[model samples]
Target: MLYRTLGGTGIEVSAYCLGTMMFGSVGNPDHAESVRVIHAALDAGINFVDTADMYSAGESETIVGKALKGRRDDVVLATKVHFPMGEGPNRGGNSRRWIVKEVEESLRRLGTDWIDLYQVHRPDHTTDIEETLSALTDLVRAGKVRAFGCSTFPAEEIVESHVVAERRGLGRFRTEQPPYSILARGIERAVLPTCRRYGMGVLTWSPLASGFLTGKYRKGGAIDLTSGR
Candidate 1:
């Protein structure tokens, strides 16, 4: 498979990163089967793996961890934060406190010393961008994470983050993982352009619209997702 250097970071990731949103209890509950998919993806030359801590309340990362037990070094692993990990008021978000703590949780679950790319899963209206950058910068400096990025941020937020990171001596967001699908083309006019302006890499999520395009979600039927909250 083809590989490309992620933005300015020297880490080379596969052209096709295996997304693990559906590998856990929220989507698929079969841990053994999920492990098979992950191994097969690695065997097929997909060296990049993207997941999130909130996925199935962290079960997805566990499966990924088990799958990469022996071959972890061959993958460019990425995961996200910002969603609530528990009922605690401060259990999640883009705040420095949460980022600093949640990253360790992510590291522990993935069974890796460093993450290839750690991303802010979504914009946190309550938290300052500088706070997030400051925390992530600490991770990079400590070698706990190679780089950090953001996902689903507005075009303006992306620009502001770059400015703030530069001004405050924090690590800049080297990538953007926005949700881009045929049903969602709004990013093309703005988000993509903003990322390009800052030389940030683009790793889109839900290019298939969470299986909406696969005829899996039947018209007029109830939604597939049932919130635990």
Candidate 2:
């Protein structure tokens, strides 16, 4: 598998990252089978594994932790935050409180001393971009997170984040995780360019348009809403 540096962080990662959103009860509930899938991806040279704290209500992280038992150091482990983990007001968002607390939970679930890349799952309009950046900066300094980035943020927000980081003298976002596929090319217009200008690495999602381009679901074919991504 081909490898590339993640943003300007100097850490190389495989071109294909294993996304574990469907590995838990929300999709595949079998722990042993999920572990096997993760192993298969690693064996295939996929050194980047991406999971989220909120995926499968944290069960996905648990399974990933199990899968990476002896192979953690060889992989560029990534996970996300900024989603509600429980039914509460302070359980989520991009605020410092949530990010600082949530990182510990993610580390525990992933069974890792430090995360290669810790990303915010989505933009939280309610929280100031500086607040989020400051918190992430602390994580990097604390040696809990190697780098931090945002996911699914628009071009404007990405720029705003960089500006805030520069003004505040904090760590800037090193990467971006956006949705990009043949069917969804919106990022190409501005988001991609913005990331390029900022020298940020990019990891795209839904490359198959959530399986639409897989040919398994045709234009006129009926799709089962209950299954598939």
Candidate 3:
């Protein structure tokens, strides 16, 4: 598979990252089959695997942990934070308290000592960007996370994060994960250029427009709305 450097981190990743959002009960309930799918992707030269703690209430990470057994060294694993994992107010967000606590939970679920990329799933308007960056900076220093980034953040927020990082002398976000596909190219306008200006890597989700452009839902064709995305 083709490879490219992940932003300024210099870590090489495959062109297509295997997104395991549907591995758990929310989508695919069979753990064995999910593991097999992960293995197949790895065997196909997909060195990057992305998951989120909020996906299937952390079950996806558990399945990923099972699949990456004895093969962790060959992969660049990424997982996201900033979503509510359970009941309670402090259970989620970009605050340092939540970030610090969630990273450990993610590590445990993944059965790995360190994560290649730990991303903030979305911006938390309530929390200061500096606070979030500070927490991630601490994770990198503590050897829990290799690098960190943001997901689905606007161009302005991305710039604000970099500014905060620079002013506060904290490690800046090395990448940005936004939704991009043939049907959804909004990021190309400003978010893409903003990332480029800061030399940040871009990882796009929903490349197939959540399967809408996968030829499964065509014009004048019967659509199965009940099917899983």
lDDT of each: 0.91, 0.94, 0.94
Which is superior by lDDT, 1 or 2?
2
Tell me the TM-score of each prediction against the true structure: 0.94, 0.97, 0.97
Global CA lDDT computed for model 3: 0.94
Q: Write the per-residue lDDT of candidate 3 for residues 28-134, one digit (tens) a residue.
A: 99999999999999999999999999999999999999999999999999999999989999999999999999999999999999999999999999999988999
lDDT of 1 by residue, 112-179 (tens): 89998999999999988888898899999999999999999999999999999889888999999988
Residues 1-229, candidate 2, lDDT per residue (tens digit)?
Answer: 9999999999999999999999999999999999999999999999999999999999999999999999999999999999899999999999999999999999999998999999999999999898999999999999999999889999999999999999989999999999999889999999999999999999998888777787778778798997778
| Order of models, best lDDT first | 3, 2, 1
- Name the better of 1 and 2 by TM-score: 2
Work out how many backbone clashes candidate 2 has.
0
Residue 187 displacement in candidate 3 (angstroms): 0.7
Please tell me which model should have the higher lDDT, number 1 or number 3. Answer: 3
lDDT of 1: 0.91
